[model samples]
Target: MVISPPEKPTRDEKQSAGRNVAIVALFAALGGMLYGYDTGIISGALPKMSAQWGIDHTRQEIVTAAILAGAVIGALVGGSLSKRLGRRKTIFIIACVFAVGVVACALAVDAWMMTFCRLFLGLAVGACSQIVPTYIAELAPPQRRGAMVTFFNIAIGVGIFLANLVSVVAAAGDSPEASSNWRWMIGIAVFPALVLAAAMLQLPETPRWLIENGTVGKARVVLRWMRPNRTAAVEETLQIWAISQQEDKESRGGWANLTQRWARPALIAGLGIAAFTQLSGLEMMIYYSHTILGTAAGFDAGLVVWSGLGIAAVYLIFTAVGERLVDVVGRRRLMLTLIPGSTVFLFGFGLMFVLTDHPNRYLTLALMLAYMACNAAGLQAVGWLLGSELYPLSIRDRATSLHAVALWGSNLVLTLTALSTIDGLGLGPAFVMYAGFNLLSFVFVYFAVPETKGHSLEDIEQSLRDGTFLPLRGNIASRIGLPDNRITTGAAAD
Candidate 1:
């Protein structure tokens, strides 16, 4: 009978490992920071770029839509690249591209050149949109995973706020048409991208990805690093290994697999949430903050930039609160609760336009701040994490690609058409249209989104395979005074 293998690490060893994992996750979140900076910087740069280039609304639409167009391609291809090269490597590549694109935008001689540069940057942003949430979720433990992954989104909001603040300071006491100032606003993002690339060199690949590639021993080592104790680490390693082996045996490849009954609902939920995330009018708010304040509220460039800072501050504040509460409150509940409130604000925001023959800048500002708070506390924090975690492990990356495609695709369409809609439909009606979109988003979340607060990745996969992953019937029906009709008490026929 010989000595059995050691059962546990020493307490000191466990503590050290947990500390290391946390440090790594914090660094990995830099990717989200870069994503936010690149996206947010452009919002501030656009006005000066338009001034310098003498660009019309159509060209403004093209310039803004270019990055989104690149993001669409990036989202579609990012999963495949991550599948081939691994997440950390793909992210490093994205960081490099972001650096190059940011510099290119800052130095571009014309609107067309700037548009092309943005296209390159969008590719990286789009890839980060898929990769960061997916990467964070795979590394975190179930009990704290929701909050952990949401930290990535919170980083994004912070980056956005900081980028806008920089713009405010950069433009302060300067003419609106100053050419070099926009370049500085656009170029400052390169520092974060550089930091992200440097930080990634120190992080490990996710354990599930390692196990899937036949590195079970290494996967166990990483889990031990993340978990608080021995039993938990071993148990999770077994759980991940067992599920991965089965998924490899039965999981089909490619989009065709999503047509299967067990896979369809998750795909629908993934893509629907993605599409609705953009349709929440987030891009319009962030990208066009200047335009909305100017057109509807009659604010000058200086006033608009100051108001942009206010919106960014509100966004950052609530996103932090949402990050902490995502696990405590549950994803579906948080989204369902906040979206209706955001819709109300969206309508009120539009109504301010309707009531005022001229601009009621303060009232519009109040409504915008309230809307930002609801969005940050709910949709903006929840959407990326949900899409990353909802699919089966076998097809997660591929499904994420398509889901991200829908996200950026929706973003592109909205950004391209926002000015036109405001022109064609009037600012009040345009706001009303956004309010309608927000209302539909609430209905969709109510009827379709599932709660994934405490479930492990493997448990969620098994639930999807069994057609029991969605609509949280007991909870939803209870909330609405109806029977739990959405619950699947028995197996599907297929």
Candidate 2:
């Protein structure tokens, strides 16, 4: 018997399916928010906790970097859990873990206890970062997948912005107990975690994953729910099953298989992209933005709050812009452009600090915003999207696990190193080191990374197998080979 390809949906049918996909993507985006809130909350809370806990710089680094270390463990284990428990179920479990971690941190009696609790919180954050975008990508139709996944970053920025706003307000109140204010900061995460856990019950499992696990009938049911009135649901389910089965025949889905011929290059590229993105020192800016602003620029707490908010706003806007254009501009081009641009900004930032005894404060702020904007446009928006798309379905789970581990590992090292580097070497030297990393990243992307903007997972897999990089093109569809009818015409349509 010949298996037919899935038929393309009609205009009305596409619209109907798109609406449902949007709703589910929004729900998944909440996971992104939790990841951002958990990570960014410490930025504001750290100062208050320092005075209350009487911790030194070294101890402070340990407290802040604990989550990143836990994230490495979480990312390593999260894939196996997703395979056993299902993606939606695993995410719900992670939400519970996040809530528990929040409570532990909020109620901690000492710095050591808070450090231990942060490891648990990092585990949840790490898992969500791996699972949420993959869930969104698998459920979304090819046409809108980029936009759907990009929502993760936007949600993350919103979470960071909210965390900062909350910190500013909490600190401003000058509670009778300043130590207690930090507790509120950590505890605020619990409300969102509980809400996300409850909200997930309404979501269906990925039809593709259901089919992969030998539940074709259940997969069909899920596809129907996701695509409601479309007759294409059955056909889409079958095609996904076929691709998954082909992948299964090639290798077992594990770390061992990740080294096989078909998987290795993609694994390297994915991990490299993830690592380089973190090594750009973006998180250093994020987790220590308050301190950097106050010390480097000699800004006060109020100025730090305002400047941080401004940076967050720039990230949000540029991330949205990048997400909208990712399909159009292609991933390689964006990275090629943004990485170098970021390096230049970092160089300028360091130089500004060194050259003038007291540099023009306004110029420094403008340069900082430029750095944030350029980062959001490229590394922040594109990193996860490319990482998710680079691997074949057979090893996607394991590959993403590895990628997440590398990302957080680099994050942990950078976070820990930044404290010592900033304190001992000074802010200028610390930033110069990051600037050097970005320069190396530009060369890596130019030589090793391929354009994956318009291509399907199968196409990307085939390209990797053949050692072919899809040529950069003016129109997006040319790179991915989407049928003209399937392409959205403009940014407005997207």
Candidate 3:
């Protein structure tokens, strides 16, 4: 006897399809929180630790930048490791590493010890930065992919905000707290690290990754959790399986695979966006916000830490704005607006420093808040979209690894030299330098970064291969493809 097929899902059932995905995105984004927390905690902890450890500004740079160094190493190998170990397992392992690193940092007696501890923390942060976006993309519905991925970055801002708040609270204490408060500030990350570790035990691997590993049954199971209808899930699984099979046939996934002519432009686009994102000084601003406030604005530690709270608040808010606006406004348009707008604010941020009179502390405050808001809305917001999407599926893991390496390496150079640059050229000149980078970033985005706002994965990859994808000038990507939200089972309009 023949069996009847499962009926199409009702509209409410379709709406409910994303429940599991929403839960998954929440947990996945928590790993991003660990990344944000680990990196962000240092902004507050560094000043206090520097004083207690008796390290000068130069030593602080070494200590502060060491994590970026470790992150670079982590990004370099993370892709290979994720492929071998599976994304779920790799992220679980990263969580464990983050816990150990934060605790070690808390216990450190000197800059050398803390710097070494931070290296491990950085490794976890770097790996999460590379893998989380890819993982999220694989799980998210096509129509809402940008919003889902942006969730991870928003979590990063939350981590930064929490870090700044911790600093403000610590600064309110008396003498003993001032000297060793860095320990409490840095050590708090351990809780979230552990939370993510626990969360991962319940999470499944992405359907794409599972399919790639010859576990089609497992892929189906995961897809059921991600899509609204079993019919849709089956369809999506088949689509993902087809892409995986084709990609595997096309490339073996290593440095050698990355050299293919078709792959090169996508690789360059991803890497260029990554490099430009970091070089625009977001890392420098993030890793050194409190320090910049102190040095450039001449705020005392109390004032600096308090001001940081404002910066962090604005960052969290605007990143959320960017998150909501990404799919609505289109990736390239948002970038076009954000990058150029940020340049104006960057110049304003620098101009305030140019005059030594400190004539208007309120104006300085306004300029900084504006700069932070715009940067969060712009560069910091959209930087990951290109890295997450531009590469071909066959080489995505390795390509993203390389992209992450470019990101952290650029981060390392900026963080490692930022203070020195300030020392050598002074604050006004340093801000001006960063502004120039943002100006340069505007040029790059205008000409290179394509709009992938509504394109399917297949169309996006094909466009990149055909070289029609770059320099996107409209809402829709140039393509011929299936209906929108191709991965979801919900009726195209249901």
Q: Write down the TM-score of every candidate.
A: 0.93, 0.91, 0.92
Which order, best to worst by TM-score? 1, 3, 2
lDDT of the structure predicted as candidate 3? 0.79
Q: Per-residue lDDT of 202-266 in model 2, one digit per residue for the tens? A: 79888767888889998887777677454667767877877777778764636677777756767
Tell me how many clashing residue pairs each candidate has.
Answer: 0, 1, 0
Candidate 3: 10-residue stretch with minimal lDDT: 482-491
RMSD of each: 3.6, 4.9, 4.2
Reference-based lDDT, residue 3, model 2: 91
Cand. 1 TM to true fold: 0.93
Candidate 1: residue pairs that collide: none
Assess each prediction's global lDDT (C-alpha) against the native. Answer: 0.82, 0.80, 0.79
Q: Give the TM-score of candidate 3.
A: 0.92
Ranking according to lDDT, highest score first: 1, 2, 3
The sequence of per-residue lDDT tens digits that candidate 3 reaches over residues 307-358 is: 8888888989999999999888877677767776777777777777776647
Shift of residue 184 alpha carbon in model 1, Å: 1.6
| The best candidate in terms of lDDT | 1
